[model samples]
Structure formats: C-alpha cells, structure tokens
Target: MELSAGKFLCLFALLSVVSAEIFFEDRFDDEWEKRWVKSDWKKDGDGAGDWNHTAGKWFGDENDKGIQTYPDYRFFAISAQFPEFSNKDKSLVFQFSVKHEQKLDCGGGYMKLLSGDVDQKKFGAETPYSIMFGPDICGYSTKKVHAILTRNGKNHLIKKEVPCETDQLTHLYTFIIRPDATYSILIDNVEKQSGSLYNDWDLLPPKTIKDPDAKKPEDWDEKEYIPDPDDKKPEGYDDIPKEIPDTDTKKPEDWDDEEDGEWTPPTIPNPEYKGAWKQKKIKNPNYKGKWKAPMIDNPDFSDDPDLYVFPNLKYVGIELWQVKSGTLFDNVLITDDAEYAKKVAEETWGKHKDAEKAAFDEAEKKKEEEEKANEKNDIDDIDDDDDDADDTDAEDSHEKDDDNNKIEEEATSTHDEL
Candidate 1:
C-alpha cells in the first residue's frame, strides 16, 4: 500500500494538533463572575478586600472584560478551578494581560498558578502557587517580571532579570515552558528572555561545584602589575598646589577699606598642578594565572530530566498584594501550545494594546494643555489687576485738580467784589 505525499502531510498535522491541549481559557465575559471565586480575605484591621470586576474592555478597547484590584494597601485574590492535567514531555504556556490603569506605583500585575487542593475561599498570599508569572513594580525602580516556578516544594525565582512594561497601557505577558527544560518570557509577543531552566533558576542545587579540599598553591603570584622598586617620584612633586588664587580677579571699586574687610579672590584649579606622583607600575615577571578550585561532583545534586513537569495542575489564579491598586487582569490562558497563546495575545492584548497606549498619551497631552491654559489665565488675571490699579490712580489725580480750580475761582471772586 503506497501512501501519497498529501496523506503523509495531513497525518503530521493531525498528530501535531493532538499533541497540544487547550486546558483553560477565560475571556472574562459577563458570565465570568460564575467562573472565578473572589477571596474573602480582609486587609489590616478588617478593611475591605476589593476586586473590581469589569464586564467589558478597559478604557473602551475591544479586548474582553477584566478584573482589577482596588484600594491602597489591600489583599486581593480570585481563582478558577479546572480539571487536573500534567505538563510532562509537552510545552506549557501561561499567558495573561495586565493594565495598570493607575500606572502602578508599587504593585504587582501578575498571576499565580495554584494546584493541589486549593480552597478558593482560603486562597491568599499565604496559599502556595505552582507558578507566579508577570510584572511587578515598586517605587522609582524595581520594574521587572517575577517568574517563580515551584518544584519539589520550593519556589525558585528566575535569576535573569526580565524587564516589564511600565506604561499605563495593557500588555500581554506569556511564560512558555518547553518540554526540553527551557523557558521563555514574552512581552507583547516578543521574547524578552529565554534560557534553560536549569541554568536560570536554582530548581536543583548545582550538579557540581568547587572541590572543598582544593586551595591556592603557595607563592603563586597572581598580581598582574606591581610598583617598580627602582622608580622614584620626580623632584618638586609635593610643591604643586591642588588649587591657587585666581590672578585675574580684581576687587570691586565699591569696597570700603575701613568698613569692609579685605576680600579674597576665588580659588581656581592650578594649571601647574600635577596629580600626586607615584612610582610607575611594571609587569610582574613572577605573575601566575588566576587560581581556580578544582570542580568535584556535588553529592546533594540529583538531576531530574523532568524538572519542568507538573503532574496535578488544577487551577490558575490571580493572588497578589497590591500597594496601589487599579491593575487589571484578563484574557487568561493555560495551554500546551505556544502558538495558541501568541494568537490569543494578538487577537486580544496585541490588538488593543496600541489603542490603549494612544488613549493614555492623549490623556497626558490633554492634562498638559489644561495646565498651560490655567497658567495663562493666571497671568491674565494679574494684568487685569494692574490695569484697575492704574485707573484708580488717574481718578484720584482728577479729583485733586477740580478741588484746586474751585479754590482759585473763590479767591478771584472775593478780590473782584472788594
């Protein structure tokens, strides 16, 4: 039986489709309320734990509805439980969109992947998560992605610093964990960081390390250069002053000799000054190479090729502590196909991210224009006050002139009668 080329190609495509799984997705539609469980955790002293759930695009973009945390210094959590699945020998993608409507001054714009008997009601910052992936910002600095993957009961944070978007617009953050123990972080469908999980995270302690017994050999001259023993400092090296009085300065003519004290000229950097002299350096002839401790097998390290596997993945949640709120999370997806995540990002976040940015820029421009207009109005008010003051002065002068003319007429009339 001969199989045609067309048949073979079709078989390949079908198998590829079968290998990947779309485990979970939420567009946060109107019915999204039923899907997510908002935690009842309270802030300090019984403050309200708020989560602002929206039923449409944020700021009027075409993306779906999203949930936003509210109130300054509050604890928020929302979770969705799903059928358990494993990500062994297959790709895993955890993707979502975040918009810091308040521009995120010290807050988290990330989500957590929780599993193993998660009580949605009890979920909070204390609840354990399998993966926590997204951006975190604080103060003036500290704007980076926080990718924490839990393995063997310990959460290992990615050592490589992956920068995150700080703008007020919606951004898509996707974390891809491949079957080959490699991971990639994507911001807006573009790869920001990619490397082996083994190298980037301390998922497992180092496989090998410097031997504890090794030590540097005696008399190993590691210095690259040393001061020349024969070289001497040039004569008069100490005589040069670091700074000198400015010879071009002349005393002001208004200075009084007796009343005013003598004035001194401002000091200037001395042109004849040379830096403190020292013996010149010479290459060390006895220099040896840098010392390195011999490596030996680490007894504690045991490599597990399936270090990236998660057997009982059940839920994906957004559990975070936001100092300043107004962080929107939506378009959450958990799948085994990398391309599917990218497509969803494009159709949703990728589609509306630019429009969100334009809206933000437009708002900023409008604010600046209003400020300028207000300043101009203030200046105009000041000018109007000045004009009023001048008119009052002119009125007073006219009144005085009339009074003087009346006095002179009265005196002239008296003289004519006499």
Candidate 2:
C-alpha cells in the first residue's frame, strides 16, 4: 500500500486533535489531601469548620450538615491550578454540583475561574467569567447559571433568571467558553441564553467604578479601568454609531491625594509613653483647645418696623429729608437726624411699579400663547381632512390602473384565439 503525502497530513491533524485534554478532576473523593484551596470569603473573617470523616462533609456558619458546616455566612472556594492555557486553546468547560441544606438570604456561593491562585488569605484575581449559583434571597434563582468569557478582559453583565426551587437537593451547573471568546451557561443541562462577549456589555468597565465622579485614587488609577487593546465595538447600543478609543480617558487629576492615600503608619500622640495610650492614662492638661460650635442667627427675630427702638435724645446734626414710615433705614442715621423716610419712598416706588407691570405682562403672554395654540389646532384639523382626500384619490387611481391591465390581458387572449 502506497501512502500519499495528503493522507499522512490528515492523519497527523487527527492525532493532534485527539491529544488535547486540559481538564484535571479529583474523582477519588479523598478527604485528607488538599486538592483544592478552600477559603472563607466573608470580607474579613477566619475560615472555621470541622470536616466530618464519617459523613464526608465540611460544616460552618449555619448550614451544618455532617459533610459541610461553616460558622460564617460566607462561601468556601476550592480551586485547582491550570497553568497550561495558551492563546491557541479558546474553549474551556467547567462542571460542578451544589447541595444546600436550607434556602439562604445572602447572595453568596458561586463558582468562577480566577486568573490568580486563591486561598484563605487572598482571593485570586479572575474575571468572573462564569457564575453557576445565586444568592437565595434574590427570588427565583434555583439553578441560575451565568456564563461570561473574556475577549479583552472585561465582564459583560448578563442577567439570567432561573426558575426558583428551594427543595432541590442538588443542582448541576455547566459552562462552555467558546473559541471566539463567547460563552454559554446551562442549568441542569439546559441552555437558556448565549451571547458574544467580544462586543457590548462584556467589554465594559466595572459598573461600580465606571462613573467619572467615582472615588478613585490617582496613584491606583490604573486599577480602576481595564484597557482593551483589541476590541472596540458599538454593538447592543443605539446612541453609539461607531467604536471609540477609551485609551485617552483617565482618572481626574483633581482627586484629593491626601484622602485617597493608602493607610500609613500613625505617629504616636506622645511617643514618650512606652506603651499603648490606654495603658498610660496620662492626662496632658496643656491640651486646652475646646471644639468650637458654629453659631446660628435667632430664627425668632422678626423684620418688623414696629419692633424698632427709638430714644428721645437730641441728634448731633440734622441732614433734613422726609421719608416714608416703612422706608429702609440708612447706616448714616446714627450721625444724621435727616427725614430719610421721604428719600426711601421715592426710590422704592419705581421698583414696586415695575414688579406690578411684570406680573401683568407675564399673564398677558400666557393668555396669548393659549389662544395661538387653539388656532393652530383648528388649522391642523383642516389640513388633516385635505390630506385624507388626497390619499383616497391616489388609492382610486392605483386600483383603476390595476383593473385596466386585467381587461387588456383578457382582450389579448381573445384576439390570439381568433
């Protein structure tokens, strides 16, 4: 048998495809060996639980079945390392099952692929490319699975509402990350939705820090935005017509550096005290500064002319002028005994007259606009009737033309027979 070059190449390609297996699973159910790293993700708390050898369980917080009991209402993440991914391999699949003793209120306990190694001390950095569980209280999240894939390393928020069931003993969640960087999630082996993560929500910045006014430090500005070098599309949007570069966009410079500075070592109020401040209750009486409280004007005070106080004493001088009783008092009244009332009335009358005229003018303008709107409506009604007549005539002409064409066809057939 003679083997051609084409046949040999096809065989080689087939062998390469068959040799690709990137998954590692711990199927032995061994309780002693730490195959996966476990951690209590309760923000700031220690992982607490006892492993039940007989029941093969880990218990903590509240749901303390024989196998699993956690003291804090936090999720214990277990992960295996896979440092073998290259740019060539695109699709990755993850499968897992979870059983809850009772329904939970807190939105916790979901599995994801972390880019970095995660353990008790720190949560590894991984774009939440997949979510297979839900917080029990967020209604109707039974086997709710959400799958996300990284094209340029941004998460596209997609909400998949699964049918709620609290009594289900165990639920299986599966995800298929495709070659094109799009992903699909399946709950109980049923795929509800699939989308391309290369465009749209998948490539957006984190929702919490997307706003320009958000609290972000100048030094750590790079952490806030994940720049995408490859993808820049305007899919799943109406306002945007084309892709735009987000490279030039940066955190505002005006952000306070002092406030945003990382926690620094504090200087002791008195370093001479060789111990904790509380242990040495040394009262330094020299610290005599009391915190000042701002003073507010008395609200009970009234701006009334009747409340004014007057003394029957001779004035130093007389700058003679007559003014109205309600006229505004001048500061010069202390030195001069002038009739300031007359000057105030003359000055204030013009302002009062103008205010009255302005009110009347505004009312007149509003009335005129209303009348104009009514007139316009009447004109629009007449125009609408004319438009209807024109439309009817155009329709009649079209129908007549169609009828004439049919009659001509009949006459032509009869002539041909003769």
Please name the candidate that would achieve the greatest lDDT relative to the true structure.
1
* RMSD to the hidden true structure, all candidates: 7.3, 44.9
Off by over 4 Å in 2: 1-20, 40-69, 72-75, 117-121, 124-143, 148-155, 159-165, 204-418
* Model 1 per-residue lDDT tens digits across residues 317-362: 8777777878888899999998768767878877776666677778
Clashing pairs in 1: none
Error of 2 at 73 (Å): 3.1
For model 1, what is the C-alpha lDDT against the true structure?
A: 0.85
Candidate 1 structure, TM-score to reference: 0.75
**Residue 131 displacement (Å), model 2:** 7.3
